[model samples]
Target: MIYISDKAKQKVDALRAEGTLASDYFLRVSVVGGGCSGLSYKLDFDNETKPKDQVFEDKGIKVVTDLKSFLYLCNTTLEFSEGINGKGFYFNNPNAARTCACGDSFAV
Candidate 1:
């Protein structure tokens, strides 16, 4: 299961209200190779769900991931922050073994 914080939910709701995304659009979370730590996280608004996709809903927001990514992201938490030194959504991934300094990438 994946966890979505209230801040994350608010951001998603605001995005949905903009009407720029498809009704089926969801937050896609995935881990890909090629980061300083050997892997990086990718997040985006996506409208497609593949056969092997795993869907999770929390706080009225939907998060989708492929089977492979699911294995690496189970129990992950999505958070959001706002400040002069911090902004945007942050992934608190229990599966990550190491994370980069910028918090944009990680390795399992």
Candidate 2:
């Protein structure tokens, strides 16, 4: 299962209230081929649930991923950072053997 960190939850809340995203919209996290690493993470707000989709929630934030992506994301945590260096969502993935410096790509 995937988890969401407190900081990420706050950012998601703020994003939901900003615009475009409605109550039904949820965080969609997926992994795709090609990056500095072998795989890259993709995140967005989505309202639709596809067949065999895996859904998980943490801190009132709902996250969805397709079955294929779920294999690479199990036991992962989604976090957000707002430090002087940078501000963005991060994937703390236990399944990843290697990850890019930006933390956006990984290889398992």
Candidate 3:
């Protein structure tokens, strides 16, 4: 099961509270190729679900992902940081062997 940190949940809640995102929207996470570290993470607010999509909920947030992405994201935790390093979402992925300097890509 994928997890979400409290900081991440708070950010998601703030986004929804701002009235920009629709009520039915859910967080969709995916892994795509061609990053500096060989794989990149994608995130979006989606209201549609495809066949065979995997669903999970954590910290009052519903997260969806495709089966193919699940293998690379297993036991991953979604996190948010506002430190001097960078301010954005990040993944604490146990399966990742290495991540890039930008923190937007990883290799397993």
- Please name the candidate that would achieve the greatest TM-score relative to the true structure: 3
- The sequence of per-residue lDDT tens digits that candidate 2 reaches over residues 5-79 is 999998888987897578999999999999999899999889999989999988898999999999999999998
> Each model's TM-score?
0.91, 0.94, 0.95
Clashing pairs in 2: none
lDDT of 1 by residue, 1-108 (tens): 989988888878887889877778899998888878887888999988888899998987889999998898899999888779875898999999889898888888
- In angstroms, how far off is 46's CA in candidate 3? 0.4
Query: Whole-model lDDT, candidate 2?
Result: 0.91
CA-lDDT, candidates in order: 0.87, 0.91, 0.93
What ranking emerges by TM-score with the best candidate at the front?
Answer: 3, 2, 1
Off by over 4 Å in 2: none
Candidate scoring better on TM-score of 1 and 3: 3
Candidate 3 lDDT at 23 equals: 82
State model 3's lDDT.
0.93
Pairs with backbone N, CA or C atoms under 3 Å apart (clashes), candidate 1: none
Candidate 3: deviation at residue 91, Å? 0.8
Superior candidate under lDDT, 2 versus 3: 3
Root-mean-square deviation of Cα positions for candidate 2 versus the true structure, in angstroms: 1.1
* Model 1: lDDT to the true structure: 0.87
Instruction: Single out the weakest 10-residue window by summed lDDT for candidate 2.
Output: 82-91
